[model samples]
Target: MTPAGRATGAGRVFPPLPQHPDPQAPFATSWWGNAWIGALEGTSLDAGRLARGRAYAREGHVDTITVAPGRIVAYVHGSRPRPYRAEIRMRTLTPEDWDNFLDAVATEPAHIAALLDKDMPHALVDAAERAGVQLLPGPGDLVPSCTCPDHGRPCKHAAALTYQTARLLDADPFVLLLLRGGDEQALLDELAQRNAHQAAREQSATTPGATGESLPGTLARDALATDYRPPLPAPLPPPAHPGEPPLLPSLPGAPNPTSLEFLATDTANRAHAYLTTGTAPFPTADPWHDAVRLAASHPGLTGRRSFSRQFAELARSVDHTPTDLSRAAAAWRQGGEEGLSVLESPWDPPAGPFDRARGALITADLPRMTIHHNHLTNASGSLQLRYGRDGRWYPYRSEPGRDDWWPEGEADADPVGAVTGMIGS
Candidate 1:
């Protein structure tokens, strides 16, 4: 059949795969991409047509693919002289679904971070599902059609295009999002606006008597003028002796004689090196240690107090409890380097969890799985199967325990089934 030129659509165009001089695998490397191909293969009634489609994909028959909201268009080279035009269409989420999904995304900061990093975290997918949004396509969700003589619902031409599209999805998850009815930039902008609005509301709620209104112009101006500026400093008198060195002030509160002595010795050494070699002192890499050193060398009560308050704020930002910070502080006071070392080391988990998980997998006759820390990782690194406290397996897209695991459907109780479902069979 002779036809016209390339297929055109109102969406982004993905260039055709480069011709492989040698035959290559048609399947996608990413699990999500494989899942898409799986849906296509599983839904087709004829295995022969599916096989032909895979061959066509492997041979690089599909031309540039166009993807838009709810639709995909492509040109596939067939037995005939002219390439056939193929199109695959999926149901786009409704406006209400998008709203619910966006709301769910707004509830978690990690969702935005993951998306920005080009990762689609399973936790975000679970949240969307809970919000009544189906981010991933299920069976029958994709409908394929091609302008070819073959009467098959998705002829080899269309199937080849679908398989190629999966490869595209594997490279860029945003393509999947765009297919679901969201423009990438628009989605990010909306998320940013929502987060900013939420922050403003929270700030207003926390402020006492905040009415969300600006003060009267004249009163606001007068208040700002009175409180915003600091008094100018007076000029200091000349030195009493031009040749004599200046005296330094004594530090207040004494601040542990041992710490002070170390500070004095270290500071003098650094000062001498700087003067002799014209080199600057190296800054401490650890913020906590730097803070302690600064506090130790501080000249007076005010300086020490400022550094102490700053250190406390830093600890709070890292989620350290008051007791934890106090213990670390005490360690610093007793033996500076040794105490910090104790605080910085990560605690080891008991071997019981790993042993139990391994035993379960062994009993299930899946001995190929490699154990890593509290999780089992596959060779591809796409699936992370974690052992939970409830004696069940959890599949995570990221590091286990860093975020919620992906939800298991019918295969929840079966560890092997869960792993297969996550990364595909």
Candidate 2:
């Protein structure tokens, strides 16, 4: 009944789950899938985005999704020609948490069957929580990021992808485990070992005066000397597709049944993938990038008027300010991970479009321009052109008495033309 903390699997890319054909049909058919939707909706600060995201999911805007330990990534199309990349990330469980969860499951054989059948009872969940294992996402657990410029904690595109993810969970609960850290086969394998040890201990217990030191066991070296032992079982095959999310029984005082089911569905899918492929997902290489990503996606940092207290304490712990967070957050809103890299890592672009744009700006003869590392600014410092490592131009306008900046213009490929267009606005 406890949410197993340590699910085991590497990352896997999943094809987009089919959009429901009927408009009137519910987005999530199974109880588990509904639970996933509930977590997303309940945590989101912006109702408008949730509504739009639901609409987008129904219309089939989300692209192929990649699920890995602690993260979900996909592309969602909106008003633009290019689909925006969106991702949601959560914290994985610690080793102790996994040990406790697996131990709990082993204590009751039915729990194992319940998971295999894609259902987790509230009793197990309560047991897990009692032991300090959080099986389902609560508010602020979901950290959302997007390449689009919208400043919403989860913009419409991210929301849409999140909505679609619920269906994937409905199809397979193992995906939830994958979200945590372990895959289906790995967990099962561990459970099987526990069962074996338990049986051995029971046999030893029945023996008269059998102490711990008197337990019957053979050394691996001795066993290897003989060849009569049975062969190991064959590797497990992957599920044809991730199965449907398991159901949690409805009961009074039970945790949100839907949310548990949603996680169950997600866990099932991940287990399926791990069974098929032995490969595991790896974490991103850059530590700095990861930190910035957390800051940008913090639920409290969504807007000027809206802030999460949790995010505030987190920022202070890391010695960062809201202004610093906003500056990087805005850059992330524009360019995702790359924008953060560009914001601090100054690099001089080779002479090409940047040079051409400078010439064009000079030709206009509006004001004397000063050039610094990757930046072109007028004498008044009101208008500036900051070039990215990728050769794309990001325009920034200085605010009176404020050091921070926001992107003002569009059409970055043609920096000169873009400067003429939105700088005036």
Q: Which candidate's TM-score is highest?
A: 2
Q: What is the lDDT of residue 279 in candidate 1?
A: 67
How well is each residue in 30-121 modelled by candidate 1, as lDDT tens digits?
76787788778778999989878878987899977767777877768877634666788887777777778878897688999988987787
> Residue 299 lDDT in model 1?
22
Q: Candidate 2: where are CA atoms >4 Å away?
A: 1-9, 206-425
Candidate 2 residue lDDT tens string, 120-224: 666666767777888777778888888777979788988898888888777777777778776777888887888777777887889887666745899989879
Where's the lowest-lDDT run of ten residues in candidate 2?
298-307
TM-score of candidate 2 versus the correct structure, residues matched by position: 0.49
Instruction: Tell me how far candidate 2 lies from the true structure as C-alpha RMSD in angstroms.
Output: 14.0
> Which parts of model 1 are misplaced by more than 4 Å?
1-10, 19-26, 209-425
Give candidate 2's whole-model lDDT. Answer: 0.69
